[model samples]
Target: MATQQSTGSTLTRAWANTALPTLGAILAVALWWLVTVALHIDPFFVPSPADVLDAFMRDPGFMMNETWVTFSRVLIGFGIAVAGGLLIAVLLAASWTVERMTMPLLAAINAVPKVALAPLLLVWMGFGNSPKIVMVVLVSFFPVIVSTMAGLTSTPADLRELGRSLSASWWQTFVKVRLPWALPQIFVGIKVATPLAIIGAVIGEVVSPDHGLGSVIVGSGSSADTPLAFAALVLLAITGVVLFYLIVAIERLLVPWAAAIAS
Candidate 1:
């Protein structure tokens, strides 16, 4: 009976935790609906939840297709950014000379506004997925590189010494000790980058006006379909939230120790 009670309590706590966010979301929507209806605000300026839902329901097919396109770009770009950032970080961490030589250049590049570069990317890469993918990589890679390098370099000196004493090879030390230690920080960078990836993809699509949620938003705006545009924005928000939580879920699964430490 005690064990069963404990399990029930645990389940209740988890449910409560999950319900809190849903409650907040419901309250926000309620407030928005109330304010919009009470003030009789024009839907063109700020669409009501019903207006946005109506727009979505009007043509769910097109919305889903565009959403899928944008999502694919985000996924591809984010994956590349993570892989490339990790490789670059490892290289930089391994060599003081490389870190010193390349760090300044990278910092300078990252300092420039990614939006300012979008037009140039469209000009160079033309109207296709290339510019969008490149934009996503550019925006997402910086945080990953920085966080991963920090994690790699911050491994305890004693751990290095212990590995050396054990006659462990560099690869072995990195794989068995340094990498695991760095996982948490690396995940931090990845989580930070995910939202940026979405923004980058959208920025690219907005500049180029190709097929994606961004393009849908742009077309809707030009056509004065504010509700449709708002619907697209809502989809983008949902995408970001879903991707962020997906990353968190992956972190919990792959690096449960890090999740436990964080908790």
Candidate 2:
């Protein structure tokens, strides 16, 4: 009976976790549908769900192509950001001098609204693809650095002492202890960076490229095609969710021990 009760409680918790937010979202959409349909508002002002879906269906191939364009830009930029951020974090973690010298400058640059710099990127990199990718790297770079540094430093003091007693080299200690401890936190930064990467890519395309989902939104807005704009946005949201979950899946695999502990 006790085992059954525990199982029931777990199942209830899982259902609540899945249902509550989904219920809220459905209710919100129904309200929007009612307002738009009942009031007979201009579809151009606030498109109905069906209109957006219809627009999506009308040019599914075209939308898919634009989505691929944006996805390529985001992945390239995010990949570069990951490689560069890890390098920077490793170097900074190793050298207090580097941390002290570079962190404040990094903070200042990160604080500058990267979106506003899109036009300048367009001028420098032009409308093809490089600017969008560069902008994505710029936008996603800082969180990775900050999260990684904190995670690296967060290695247990006792663990370091143990490593020292074992006469482990700095590389040995970091590889054995610091990096593993940092993985979860590093994944947190990655989760934060994913959407930022998407936003950066789209913003870059908006200001520069004549292709990609951002370009579709830009083109739609130019003609005041609300449904098309909304459709592009829907695609963007889907891409972000998919990318975020992919990272999550990778994290789950690499950090299964952590997951087991959590369970």
How would you encode candidate 1's per-residue C-alpha lDDT over 153-196 as one tens digit per residue?
88899998999999999899999999889989999999999999
Q: Compose the digit string of candidate 2's lDDT tens values, residues 146-200.
A: 8999999998889989999999999899899999989888888989999999999
Task: Enumerate residue pairs that collide in model 2.
Answer: none
| Each model's total of backbone clashes | 0, 0
CA lDDT for candidate 1: 0.94
Question: Residue 179's C-alpha lDDT in candidate 1?
Answer: 84
For model 1, give the RMSD to the true fold: 2.7
Which candidate has the top score in lDDT? Answer: 1
Candidate 2 segments whose C-alpha is farther than 4 A from its true place: 1-28, 260-263
lDDT: worst 10-residue window of model 2: 1-10
RMSD of each: 2.7, 2.9
